[model samples]
Target chain A: MNQTIETMLNHRSVRKFKEENLSPEQIQMIVEAAQMASTSSFIQAYSIIGVTDPEKKKKLAKLAGGQDYVSESGHFFVFCADLYRHSLIGKWENADVDDSIMSMEKFMVSVIDASLAAQNAAVAAESMGLGICYIGGLRNNLPEVSELLETPEHVIPLFGLTVGVPDQKTAVKPRMPFQSIYHENSYRHQKDTVKQEMNEYNEAISAYYHERTAGKRSDKWTEQMAKMLQRKSRMYMKEFVEGKNFAKK
Target chain B: MNQTIETMLNHRSVRKFKEENLSPEQIQMIVEAAQMASTSSFIQAYSIIGVTDPEKKKKLAKLAGGQDYVSESGHFFVFCADLYRHSLIGKWENADVDDSIMSMEKFMVSVIDASLAAQNAAVAAESMGLGICYIGGLRNNLPEVSELLETPEHVIPLFGLTVGVPDQKTAVKPRMPFQSIYHENSYRHQKDTVKQEMNEYNEAISAYYHERTAGKRSDKWTEQMAKMLQRKSRMYMKEFVEGKNFAKK
Candidate 1:
């Protein structure tokens, strides 16, 4: 396999990072790589905020459910789904129209754009031998994050990224078998593989935990996933979008 | 910069394509790479449906606002924001605890997960000398597309991708000046550079279009964006997300 493909296939999210700093030149190059990512309809509806201040980083870490890496990583950025620029652009020269910019689809384009750019930066950092992690906890307290970032209307803090040299090593956790998620024609229109494939995956993952933790913490994938992850979190996303004037009503 | 970074920076959305099919090995490697992408909290909340039927492809092409490449690429896949597996996991295990699976945050997690996986597939495809185009137009007629795919509730058809050999070559269009979107501390907390940078970008993009199209079209970034793209499209996204039983209420 080629270098690019190899880097992508061997992906990992690193939480513990060494104490080091990225050079300005290196950060510039990474940001340039992010800019090169394709934006939807060329809207370029995203912005990256580099948090260099230790105090701010510390507070951000606390805000993101005390994810220490948010402060510990040598570099951190909050990717915002931004439509303020489009509004600003509308104010200039396009005075006669800007109604479509306020639609739900347009707002989603910004969110997707932010996600795409952040992923590109993640791949770029990993390829450069730097470790990285995404802090979804940024949304653990959404309004506070917006206040902290001082984002204007039409902008929302989608997520934060932490990048640094790795200070810990970890295994790449197994994913569901290829056939389970990637299907021919359609998963629904085709066959029901969930019961069968998931049963097998449960075995593999159960074994994985048993082997990894010496049988100390053996939790099945579905059981643990349902109990842990499928919780009622971020119910205010609707409010968050609406409060920010991104409701596209 | 390294080869991987170069590959990413050189990416282009290929709409035109050579009529060729990808070998099964190539497709497997690409999906493997997609599976390897990092998921939010390892939930892996996404599924990919490869649409190989010419009849289905034709219908999808029409559904996506008549985007010809949806059928022309000879290979197509739809990325679904899936929480169905999580719900099923809840059903089999934590029957009483399925409340959280329907949260808005969980839904956003799935959307972001799907996008991350799709972008990895795009990068992997580009790495192997293949071309890709993301059809957000898949959402142009979202509910119908879902019915056509037979996807159940809590599964939204997020977007579609087309992959094949490139039948056209295009220059990399210019992005906003790096400093405009890449802020040192914050865009709002710091200074507003949008006007200045956009002024320069407008000139750059105007020149790009002028040269590329040989004066057949000349539209500034903000002007064209305001004139053409700012129309209110996909206003039903709010209702669609709410209707999927994935609502965060």
Candidate 2:
């Protein structure tokens, strides 16, 4: 395999980081890589906010549920699904585009755009021998995070990427089996087939957790997923996205 | 720059492709790379469907608005945001996870997961000297596409990826100015500042279209965006996604 595939195959989220900052050149390279990702309809409905200020990083760390890595990474970037520029374009052309921009399709487009870009940035960082972690914890308080970042309407912060030199290395977490996630020609929607595949995956994951934690924790994938899902986390996301004037339709 | 960054920066969607099918090994490698992408909380809420049957590809090409590449590519993969496995897990564990699964937060997670994995697969294919294009046109008729794929509830087809050997090379389309998309710490929300930046971009894009088409077409970015957004598209996406038992909360 080539270096690119090798880099991807060895991917892992790095939470701990060395006390060092990325050079301006590195950050620019990462952002440039993100820019090259494909955009739906060439809308490029996304933006990257580089958090360099110490105070801002500290605040974001707390806002992200007290994740110290959010403050300690070499550089933290917030990826935003932004349609503000489209709104401006509509205003300049005197076109009523609000109905289109507020539609669920556009919202999905923006989210997909931001996500594809973020993944490219992650790969770019990893290729440069750096470690990266995606901090979904930013969603814990998006309104405050948006206020702190001074984001405008039609710009929703989706997630944060923390890139830095590695302070620790961890094993790549095994994913669900290929049969479970890959279908040929059409979906294998039979429940019994899926259950058998998932049960096998559950055993593998339980073994992984057991080995990692030295028997302290060995939860099956189903048990962990059920527990997490039963809690009903992030119930405010719909209202919050609507508040930002997105997906209102 | 390294080969990985070089691969990303040189990305251009290929519509015209040489008529050659990819080997099974290539497909496996690409999907493996996709699985290596980080998932939100390890949810892995996505699946890839390899469309190989000629009849299926022909129907998909029609479903994707007569995009020839959808049928002509070396291989086409449909990336889907899936929670079917999780729903099954909940059923097995006797846990009430429907509230969480139906939340907007989980919906976003699934979409992001699918997008990230698709991007990784795209990069892997490109690194192997294959051309790749994302077909958002799959959303044109989601119900029919889902029915064709036989996807179960909680599984939404996000988009399709067509990979092949390039028959024609195209220059990379210019993106917005770096300053326009990248902000420092906080978003630069001033309308005038953004307007000025976008105006400069408009000139660049207009010139690009002019030169590329030898003056046959010269549309400014704003004009194109306004025209496209003026027409309401994909009004059925919300109802379709909700019908799939997602984002209903």
Docking class of 1: medium
- lDDT tens readout by residue for model 1, B2-31: 987898889888999989988888888888
Which 10 consecutive positions of candidate 1 chain B have the poorest summed lDDT? B184-193
What is every candidate's C-alpha DockQ against the true complex, given to 2 decimals? 0.63, 0.90
Alpha carbon lDDT at A219, candidate 2: 81
What lDDT is obtained when candidate 1 is compared to the true structure? 0.81
Chain A TM-score (model 1): 0.94
Colliding pairs, model 1: A100-B231, A231-B100, A232-B100
Q: Candidate 1, residues A60-90: lDDT per residue as tens digits?
A: 9999898899999879988888888778777
Report per-prediction Cα RMSD to one decimal. Answer: 1.9, 0.9
State each candidate's clash count.
3, 0
Clashing pairs in 2: none
